[model samples]
Target: MARHIYACPLRWSDMDAFGHVNNVVFLRYLEEARIDFMFTQAAEAGAGEFAGGSVVARHEIDYRRPLVHRPEPVTVETRVTRIGGASLTVAYEIKDTAADGTETVYVQASTVVVPYDLAEGRPRRISPVEREFLSRFMDEEVVAV
Candidate 1:
């Protein structure tokens, strides 16, 4: 599967008093990558259909290591793990780059997102075009920590 990579800049505020990234901030990183993948990589029409068309139904995250505040960018890799009738699972890995150029994974996460219709106030089926665009990132194997 093709993973969409996003370079996430770590903010000082993202760290806690322990000098490592706060656990809650990891969710933000995942959200950024998900938005970038869906809105930027997907087609314009498909992207439009996604506007307020999805909601995170669940989030499962495993923190492997602590991430310290750094000037270098962190990398977030995102891919579609499963696509169902009304929802899809997006897997993510947040990694920090070291001076030696090694990447250490800090977190592994997955989010179940359901396509929603605001006007009708309910879940909606994934459109064919949207599925086609999302298939580009589909992976047969599940991503785990």
Candidate 2:
């Protein structure tokens, strides 16, 4: 499957009481990766200005292992699994290069985001241009929502 991956360094705040990357922080890393991929690296895949007009309809996160805080950096990988007219489902993976075993998969997350009418505060169908733009993330075949 085709995928979009974004990499970033781990920050000091990402550590927890155990001196390893906290579980909750992984979700935040996923969020940052999603935003970067959709807006910067692949702006062509974004619908429109979703900062204040987007709504997250559903979210799922799976933690595979604990990330130890090391002097080196960790990377977050993100990709869009599928996209509908109004909704897009995105996935993420966080990993540390030094880690071995399943500890490789530090985190995984899936999120469904929908465009909304900022004025009416209700869900809305994506615009034609936006729909065309977002299709780039798909697997060459459109999936029904």
lDDT of each: 0.84, 0.71
Candidate 1 local lDDT, 47-117, one digit each (tens): 56776667999999999998888897789988898888888898899986688988789999999998899
Give lDDT tens digits, candidate 2, residues 1-145: 5566666667887888888888788777777776776555544445446654777788898888777766666677666677787788877777755534444777778889887789987888766666555565665566646
RMSD to the hidden true structure, all candidates: 3.7, 3.3
Q: What is the lDDT of residue 20 in candidate 2?
A: 82
**Model 2 steric clash pairs:** none
lDDT of 2 at 27: 72
lDDT of 1: 0.84
- Per-candidate TM-scores read 0.88, 0.77
Clashes of each: 0, 0
Which candidate leads in TM-score?
Answer: 1
Error of 1 at 110 (Å): 0.6
